[model samples]
Target: MVAWLGSYGTSYFGEKAYPKPGAVIMQYTGLSEVTKHEPPTYECVGTRDGIASYHSVRSYIRKIKKNGTDAEIQIFDGLTHGFGLGEGTVAEGWINEAVRFWERQVK
Candidate 1:
């Protein structure tokens, strides 16, 4: 299992230096490319995020699902980039959701 955010999340898909993780918890990354053997993925991003496009992230999840790899996403309203833990925001509790997704994937 791996939990990554932003550029690290993007690299999780691209990096070939290490063995692939069984599941990935990705956040706020617009970089969307589905590898041949992508692990199950969980993602979250805010609609108001300036850095990562919400649509791009959705498309990425769709692509992953299309390829038969499990994927899920949480889109928060009126939130911006890097809203860490989303404390006091609509995105609060997103980590719990991501963890649940990770658990399902690993099981």
Candidate 2:
């Protein structure tokens, strides 16, 4: 599953209903109170994101990791919310990193 912004929330909310996904890649998502499932997850967010707090993402990832799930996260400096693929910003190579993370999950 690949989700951005608001859709990330949907993924978190629906985790219980669906079979565990192979992996999840989320960007710029807010905090959720839902239970964390064991799945490899890769998440990224800009430090300057206004819509979704970077701290929230960090906390969520930490919680997932504590549950013994493989979780990875990246925080790009001076970036804002909704910077998909990070475009020409400092986060430009994020998509490649995400792909690599997904590949690791498959292995």
Candidate 3:
């Protein structure tokens, strides 16, 4: 499993994004083409990741479900975005969830 922030258009949000119009357009356009996935996906993202907005994850999950997959998202309220799994972190909760989901899917 891998976790990463959608940093593709972050440059538009960076300084020198004059007029705001260009930045807005780029942001919307980027979101329009988010990735797609098949069913049986177990996805987790933090609400406070500050990287990809909640909307991005929500959109992806919806697309997965529309494709008939079992997609799950566990959004940690106080955690920053992209706090991915590690050996000795609270992210263990998410890892455990994924393992459980994988077991069920494989069964």
TM-score of each: 0.82, 0.79, 0.57
Tell me how far the alpha carbon of residue 95 in candidate 3 is from the true structure, in angstroms, after superposition.
0.8
* Candidate 2 steric clashes: 0
Model 3 segments more than 4 A misplaced: 1-39, 86-92
Ranked by lDDT, top first: 1, 2, 3
- Whole-structure CA lDDT of model 2: 0.77
In TM-score terms, candidate 1 sits at: 0.82
Q: Quick one: RMSD of model 1? A: 4.5
Per-residue accuracy of model 3 over 1-107 as CA lDDT, tens digit each: 12112323324446443221111101111132434334355566555667666568667667756766566666555566546573354455677777777777657
Off by over 4 Å in 2: 1-18
lDDT of 2 by residue, 24-77 (tens): 888987854425544677889999999888998888788878888788999999
TM-score of 2: 0.79
Identify the superior model by TM-score, candidate 1 or candidate 2: 1
lDDT of every model, 2 decimals: 0.79, 0.77, 0.49
lDDT of 1 at 47: 95
Q: What are the per-residue Cα lDDT tens digits for candidate 1 across 44-99?
A: 99999888899998998898889888889999998889998998999999999988
Candidate 3: residue pairs that collide = 39-69, 48-81, 49-81
**Candidates 2 and 3, the one with greater lDDT:** 2
